[model samples]
Target: MKLQESTMHQNELINLNEYLLTKGFELSEEEIAKLVHVQKEICKNLKWIELDESKLYKIILPYTLSPYLSFDNKMITLENAILIYYKIRSMFDWHLDDETCITTCFKTYTSLYGIQDKELIKTIIIGLKKEGYNNNANDFNESF
Candidate 1:
């Protein structure tokens, strides 16, 4: 018997998102791309929020819900971005970093904040992760 292998392209498996939107209920390829761009922005913002906590407060403030949050710089580590997404939207508190002392923290930002306009935010977060983010779910899962 011979073993054969087939290849699937990276961007092949996709299910249409009914929640995806434009001015109305429609998402063109360009619109989809735009959504992806928004996700990257959200990821960047999450990272900035974390940096603000780690650097400014000198204490790891519990993550928060930030709908309008954004990172002005394009230098946030992919790891941090993913953590922000998972924590804020999923309410998942896991470690996505090594230097952080504690883990499994609760959200710092208000819950309502994240729930407001959450779909757009979630889309962006998932997009960023797809773009290559390595987050440690344990970061948010650490409690003690």
Candidate 2:
């Protein structure tokens, strides 16, 4: 049940690709490979803890997909995506508390990346909520 043990699978990749397609992105093989590699790195860097696959996917998918999400009609660069992933991962490792992890990660990412897009923030909040995090839309209202 370790985080690394719940690494992304082929089905998940397919699902991710399908999800992206629904969002108007058709990822090439290279893009899919890059996502897999980055996701592995993200999981590898995290501390091992008992986490269910469903919960892990709910928590991690947003980080994996964030780079592709259009904010003000611009996609976030891969470099920025990796930085944001690690920043959130680092916070998760240090805090080890789901109650504050999402909020802290959101605050830190925005402070460093200067992301002010409401839709992107809402997507992240919704994803985290799927993992059963207590934070809600109200937690982010003042920021956006």
lDDT value for candidate 1?
0.32
lDDT of each: 0.32, 0.47
Q: Would you estimate the TM-scores of all the predictions?
A: 0.26, 0.40
List clashing residue pairs in candidate 2: none
Q: Per-residue lDDT of 1-144 in model 1, one digit per residue for the tens?
A: 122211121121121222222112333456435434544565575563332212211111222112323333111322243444334443322333322321222221233342223343344434435545443343333321
Regions of model 2 farther than 4 Å from truth: 1-8, 38-60, 63-68, 71-79, 91-94, 97-144
- Across 40-68, the per-residue lDDT of candidate 2 in tens digits comes to 56666554332444433344345444543
Instruction: Summing lDDT over every window of 10 consecutive residues in candidate 2, give the lowest-scoring window.
Output: 71-80
Clashes of each: 16, 0
For each candidate in turn, give its C-alpha RMSD to the true structure in angstroms: 15.2, 9.3
